[model samples]
Target chain A: MQTPNTYRAGPDPDGHFGLYGGRYVAETLMPLVLAVEEAYNAANADPAFKAELDYYLKYYVGRPSPLFLAERLTRHFGGAKIYLKREELNHTGAHKINNVLGQVLLARRMGKRRIIAETGAGQHGVATATACALFDLPCVVYMGATDIARQQPNVFRMKLLGAEVVPVHSGTATLKDALNDALRDWVAHVDDTFYVIGTVAGPHPYPAMVRDFQCVIGDETRSQLHEAEGRLPDTLVACIGGGSNAMGLFHPFLDDPSVRMIGVEAGGSGIATGKHAASLNGGLPGVLHGNRTYLLQDDDGQIIDAHSISAGLDYPGIGPEHSWLNDLGRVEYVSITDREALDAFQLCSKLEGIIPALEPAHALAHVAKIAPALPRDHLLVMNMCGRGDKDIFAVADHLGVKL
Target chain B: MRERGYWLALAMSRIEKRFAALKAESRAGLIAYLVAGDPDLDTSTKLFEGVAAAGADLIEIGMPFSDPMADGPVIQAGGLRALQNGMTLRKTLALVRHLRARDADTPYVLMGYYNPIYRYGAEAFAEDAAAAGIDGLIIVDLPPEEERELADPAERAGLDLVRLATPTSDEHRLPTIVKRASGFVYYVAIAGITGTRSADADNVHRAVSQLRRFTDLPIAVGFGIKTPEQAAEVAKAADAAVVGTALVDRLAQNLDSAGKPKPGLVDAVLADIAALASGIRTVRK
Candidate 1:
């Protein structure tokens, strides 16, 4: 248990991040999962794979997105000088493209013909569809029916990219149900298919593979802040659904004991009302979707439906690495409510002239709470993980305004 | 004689007795599967009590979870109906106790995902399930690598921890799978979820033979045996043929428009089981 040497050496060789992650899938997929692991390990060691990923990230995903200081917002907070890592500027308008390119490339290298994925907010779906189109591979995405209704633009986008979007109608028709169907698809088609998991969850290699792909966010932020301020930032913050963007930003800074990290979860209405997506704050450890993590479930362990205004953040479980980091006290996990995120969404748009995604607005809400209390010299950076174009309809519906 | 001594030490578990009886009969067995509390608790209980009488050599009761990812549409709907009717792990165990009070010869295994048992407290669940007369467990989600917590507790309670060997399981992984398995090796005849496709007779034959090379336990072929023909084909390849989706489909066919069981649901399912049993009896391993 003590051999982490660093907070990043994790997942061990067997894909365990200290009991939080293991392959809990059915025996029918165990060999396939191991085969994927073997392929990923080989590709990870190959210089050509690294160079190819770098080429795609730099050209396709538009890597090294700007880290701009929000002067007006910082002055409004009157405390920490807030900076935003503008991941929303990336291709497909989210940090999800980072992982998509990495996974799709790996799928091709494994000689897989079809690509499959599951989506919650449609951002990952759109990203995967785009990558599959670029590679000219047949792609299928499983989305919850409720999500397709809310995130309609992304559905259209995926269809336009020549990807099939299948709506899952089971179990509250949400992200977890989409995941269940995607996994079922994998089991049925493991011979020629690859599953492009969007977030830092599911069974590892996935949690670790996704984190490594998205680590560009943190790696860039670290050097950018040092070049500007001559030292490490005091704090890093990001919103978490399955905790990919947060993991991306925090994993690079985990060994820096001087820096603090916070992952904000969605508090739909309130945690006490049993309607929130705050797994770490209000749930218990259990296995779901092939990994052990904090899951929102009843006493009988039936996965409870998660509620959030931001569909991206409405998952019942966090990434296993996030759960492990919470256990190690490496990153502080907190929750923000719908009203708080909505307010932050509007405030960030007006103050910084940046319309942020509802997912990152949760992180901004937490920043609003703490930034005012910190010293003026304190530096804080938050990941603006996605844009708000796909969310305007939901935002208007919540605002009681006709779109 | 040596196997009987081994059974004597464990008080002759029902699973062992059932397998021994099937061996003596020199024909493949039939396992009738049902989701506990489907449609309603009473109907499920009636069907549970009727399977053995109707000719089921073994019974498998599904402990319904909200998300049964490993099941096809029929069994998934069956589980949903059971969950809607207020079936929990506790209630399923109570049904087991009920089955034990009346019949002691028919061995039954509980099939489900691992979350419910993990939530029920694995140690407590194993002891409670064993006490309630459950013979074995086919937890689809908990592979051998992750079964240590529940396996130890289940073993201490004298429950058989059954393992599933799928078409995807290669020679290297077979040892790890059989090393921890106790009751029998469930050979998933296809590399897919339950009840979706029919197993190829040739593939089942080869896979069953391959499994025997490593494990001395009886082999049960499942996961796509939907018809009497398919069941008969699997019976020729393995020790038993498990027909879950077919029986569940029969129950579904008897249900009314609103998903409530009609008057003859029990009889229809039992008849289906009897038909499968007859078909399996036509073939010998």
Candidate 2:
């Protein structure tokens, strides 16, 4: 088995982390993909690009988000010192802003006039629209009709940001369908459009580029934890949908073998009931989107609709880096059911005065499971990736609350 | 497994024979595409035979996927309708078998994304597809970089893994694409999904002329050849004009309000095919 240090150097020159990430697209989009790859590589090497990104992240999106010690939750667990990486405090109320800001800037640098993206939970859509609004670029977001109906606030939010939200109705009408629509749009308008894939999935350069952008979460967490606790945390936890937040937090800690990482997946109902979005936990390795990774697909390779109370985690496939890490056993992956996540959602609200989004609720649910068993001296940090404002209606409906 | 030369030789024989026949007649071939179980299997099967009888030289059967990222709304709807009516990879191959049972001369190619074949097991899919008389394949999402997964098995089964060269496939990438490409080269005239925009004939001619410098394989121009006029214009530049979304659109146009196939659906599809075939046949002269 490869050590954590060896795993950090992926996805190589061909954009592959073992057999996971590569450019699996049509011929018409090849040149555009290549151009994006070249531009990203040059920007990655340019110090001016990094300086501009740092400037925006610090002043605009409010980077270096706090790492707060959840004292009440720590007392409740009574086993480990619990700390929360407060990504929910960011401008877009989620870790998604970190990636969108970087991608929109890169798109502008490449002279791309239009920006396109796919969103499931509307957080990424809101963040992408926010960046486009700030950059004065035309933006279009493809969202599933089902998602649009459920996430009406984010829909209106995107429209308010001057983005045209196209509701895709084909093929299960979810994140996968929305992604398919976005790819079709990119293919149709390859000349002037830049597809800002929300997650760390998709073709070459995406898994890597999105990971690079999101590493800010882990980078800040590492420094912040050192300043607060005088040492690295013993354990790290984050939720995984297409696994952007998890990758963001885990990439910086990969080389630190002393810090164990756990990725929590949305186990809607349960894995046994076949109604969950636990791609790494329940799915098999297959090709989807633009990369080879773990996917929820049937015997005929047709992608199955993933079920999760949180639309953000309701995707059939995961990022290739997550797939590679799962294979390497560097990061442990587990599932938390909807009922458990709901319980954690309320627990964090009352105990820590934090109403986390349903996505991070999954991570809190997993924290509830193991936090009580560890030693009090042991330290655990969880990514509070999003706030619960957008999910209040869904949670209320699930809990049968009249409000 | 047969040697590379052996597989290439056998793969070219059938496809080359069709193109050679078209060349001798001083005209281009009209390739028609249809979702295997659009609306339903029986109607799609009827449309398949009707297209061949209506003068289409080659048939491209679309194996509908649940998620077709490379397709536009029209073809995406067609696939959804097919899946709703019970379209599976196994059923699609069976449809090809049924078509090949009576008509043995025309060439048949299976085109779609790779997930279904990967799910069916690549080796088994190759065996079944070849046994069902599939001559070539054009997996839209599987590029040359990721071809090893299915290409080797398909070629071993004597099925041509027909590769696509697009408007964006620049001079540097064309060699790698045409290297393992068999049967013929599918030149996507537009840099977009199916049925969106028309391809300029001048650009199509220039691309085909450029591609001719790399390989001897017959080139087929597709994607946005919607009208008979557009098909005829494309045929003047390429060996074949492949039309898919236009045919799918005709199927959609003749559908009832409930999304069921109307009575004139087959007639409408066949009429469109006949018109396109006529336009393509008269192109060179």
Candidate 3:
């Protein structure tokens, strides 16, 4: 397991992902944000904090999820050998729990009594609620009114765990709106509330801290692939929402010169057609949701609404680190249109006998386009970050077919 | 009939008087907001001069937040422009420090949301804001309940804490909110969010009259006091009118193709603001 110190937030005082990520929030949340940064700084170094999080990740969260070789899918594609980091098998059924467990434990250590989270797809909300239940802490999840209806099952799961889900009706009533509501709630209750932000975004320490916790997925993937294939993977692929799951799988492989990391974004219609959440493909450097990142914003800098079949991926901003990676040329972001993602969802299910969450299905869909051109001897690893069980209705509706 | 600095001079006079009696004034005072570093800080500086000239009472140099929930699109766009122009809280405070050098009597208020203040530590912020010539603070998000952490330190620095009282505040909470407030009470009227227009003038008059019963403190109503007509309706009951989103919206309109402030826009907005202030007179018994 990687040491907790491996992902320390600060050392970059200006909040940069190697010259990106700065405090871009409203002036109201600054002091609390500073407090959070200070708290994370002190807590990340404490042995007790490290040990407690390790216990949950191993015993409670059931981490170090297997990296399985998708041999048949690789053969069918006739390109690079495909490997899957099975985060879908993790407790709470996604890579989100890995982060929630880490944050909840940090919250307990900080002596914070309440947890607040914002969810678009509700995976983070469910994960936060689960952690709150385990620790007997009060939890409040802010979900966009639109998401409350679309991601109802996860909303139900959060409620079943005794978390109160607040429906945010402001602005487009989606992930960004939920984030606005969560910030409001945190500002209202900053004294005792620990905001368990679900992604690799937000101000300093959060982006860095969440990535550190989630890097387990990457660390495990690297070792598991090495054990299976006797070498590092030639290509790594993951979907980008706030880019958390992608960061988890990409962090360890970041320094590997031979590895080509690909981030697939939701191109609702297509980037060329202009209705998409493909920030890296079609975005400018702008400030939003706490950091300076690649954002889908207008020339005047008003954040543009994003569209994706997957509610999780329908955010106009990508993680600040992803912005830096894009700038550094370490990662290339590709867009997979809604039609392509939906087709990939069916193809993966039929050929691999695995139904991928629509978010990751975007990345899988990219492989269908990029893989055939690569040599068969090379290896490509895709993070099967979540399960599609939560997305059946959405995929069905998109196809105009009954579930 | 008026010189460029004529309106500018009126804004300066008000800023001077407000700070001179800040500590002694028992009736909570009014702090007027105009986006700092807006329309080029030169004009913003002149606008501050105009605010001082106009007997603004107290000055709240708004450090604009990008997503101003309570603000209408006009103010929201104004704030975005301010940020785009490289207007940071540090720079806004620096402008106040610049003002302090010329006229030391008028108290400056740094009114904004929390993010920028958080970036600078609250305790350290109080000290720095005081050093920068800011004499009061009104953070919209920091209510009485969340005051101990920020308000206590600010008060120690001799800066006043101006809290808001919305229409939704109940009788029990109103008094408590009033008791804790160090400066004038801000009464937000007909809020769904911000920047939207108020349909009725009479409703605003009635709301202001209702607020007067709670405290002897100066009560100002904001949220939709846009035009001179609206200000006149509010002036009947309220001690001062808060014209924010309206002023900000004007500046946003004046922005050029590159989003920079056009000088023509500044002059035009100042003319409108002058007309609005001149239109409303303090109500007589």
Candidate 4:
């Protein structure tokens, strides 16, 4: 496949980002999926849709999330300047709400009466539930039973937000099964329900649509960095599970040849230990959850269970566009161990006075490694995608505390 | 100019041959479906023979996948049971070869998602499946738009790539779906997954009549077929009625505490298939 002159012109009319993404759903949902593509494209062209989304994002979602200089962390590393895109400070405490509001608005525009979503750590579920509450739509969230147990607070948050949380006890009872259950629900209720896929994954129109909604993060960073540093940043880093946050941050800078970008995957233990969620590092290209991407699957094409300390990163496959970009060698894909992320979590909490979620801590861990090697003038940005308030219990338990 | 649908009527694939024969006999076919290695290899192995002997005109063997979102809870459990019993695509193909060693006349269609076959390498899988005496394939997730991945290889290997026409397939989408499909089209009786709702007879009649306008391929109705009466209703308008979850549920009822099949498990499942066959045979389509 010939590389396009511009990196952003992807996911052609049939939803193929160079054979990595397509609608691989059952025939019962094919028309609905196609309708979603049509609806999203129409929504993109309408100024009213953008104005409504901007209105909600600025007021309800609290957009334009600040980009702060981590001066103490930079001093600790004693190398290149470091900046944190404080997505954790947003309403619902993560970057998930940005895409949720956009999708819920699209659903409303299409006259869908119900909202459904799948979540691993419940961040997306909470975000969806909050948006549904604001929009007065009935929300259904499918979460793995195991995730419900581990992330009790976020599950409770979703319930309090008036969403019915269905626990999926299917194979492995994790994010993949939750995704399976969500797709099943969508197939069953295609007429009234609109499925708000959490990340930059799923059947077409979703990866592209979600990334377009999330480009605000990178778009802000580009102009914000230029204002602060008077030039484009040298390097960009963010962790990936289904890879929405990283895609949002990396996509805006993809054409800038001088800006080096890296996607940090969750190496649960380490690659050598054979227990990790690093799809790009230890997996191959395959199909799962409606898209063909890099998946952790066995020899017989059965999806293998992915492991990570961060529940948000506990998915067997990465998004299709990420897989395509990885193939194009446009963005560097790497891994960070759980132990490294844990240390980085504590270091950011102590030095920067802002605790980070375990998901972004993986990106911060990568930042810690490369920060010391560069000169002081080199600007680096890491997406602080979520706060650690929801992760305190898990972190405390991991540290042998009686939390 | 000769129309494309005219050429579609001339192709006599193996499964199509069985449907035509059933039509000539003035009886709609009973297409029984079961996971390849449900419960255990011994029990599922017995089931392949039992259903064939129970007067099932055509058979649809489900290849178990870890995430079968298109199926309901009962079929999902059945697939999980088969996978737990160490069933893989290669093992399922081996099971088909085993079935062929005894009964070569029964038309077999391997039905499942696409990932497993993709992992086995599509070309090798197509050739191997044809060699194993499998007649057709119904990959639930491989839509017509994405047929380029497996279409050529399945054609090269002489295996019928059966297409599923659902209620969600609009008029504009109907021609595109059946244009490339070789075997009898499997018309899903309902918009939902398998075993959830009893397919409304009026809806099935309407959907089947609409499908008749597109192509001459024999239509086999499946999904939401729970009872012999429901099977008979579906068979009245379509060429065949596929009863899967009802039979899988009966098989599940006969399993012992240890997940093994009990003494009469094989006979019970075969008897249900025979009951459904008799029901479909009662209807003159």
| Cα lDDT, all candidates | 0.92, 0.92, 0.76, 0.92
Sorted into a CAPRI-style docking class, model 1 comes out as: high
Q: Which candidate is the best by lDDT?
A: 1
Per-residue CA lDDT of model 1 for A92-176, tens digit only, reads 9999999999999999999999999999999999999999999999999999999999999999999999999999997889999
- Once superposed on the true structure, which residue ranges of model 2 sit more than 4 Å away at CA? A1-5, B1-12
Per-residue CA lDDT of candidate 3, range B1-285, in tens?
899766765644333344335324423233356888875677788777766556445566777765554455465556666776767777788888888888777667777675456556679889888787777787765555345657878878777777776655656556767776655667776533455757256776676666678876667677767777777667666766777777777777777788766768756666666656654543332
Better of 2 and 3 by lDDT: 2
Interface RMSD of 2: 1.1
In terms of lDDT, the poorest run of 10 residues in model 2 chain B is B5-14
**Interface Cα RMSD for candidate 3?**
9.0
Give candidate 3 misplaced runs (Cα > 4 Å).
A1-11, A26-28, B1-29, B32-66, B69-285
Tell me the lDDT of model 3 at B277: 66
TM for every model, in the order presented, reads 0.98, 0.96, 0.68, 0.97
- Candidate 2's TM-score reads 0.96
| Candidate 4, residue A337: lDDT | 94
Model 1 sits at a Cα RMSD from the real structure of: 1.7
lDDT of 4 by residue, B165-211 (tens): 99888899998898897878999988788899889999999999999
Q: Candidate 3 chain B — worst ten consecutive residues by lDDT sum? A: B22-31
**Each model's DockQ?**
0.85, 0.76, 0.06, 0.76
Residue-level lDDT of model 3, residues A287-328, one tens digit each, is 566676787866434567889999989998988888877876
- Output the chain A TM-score of model 4: 0.99
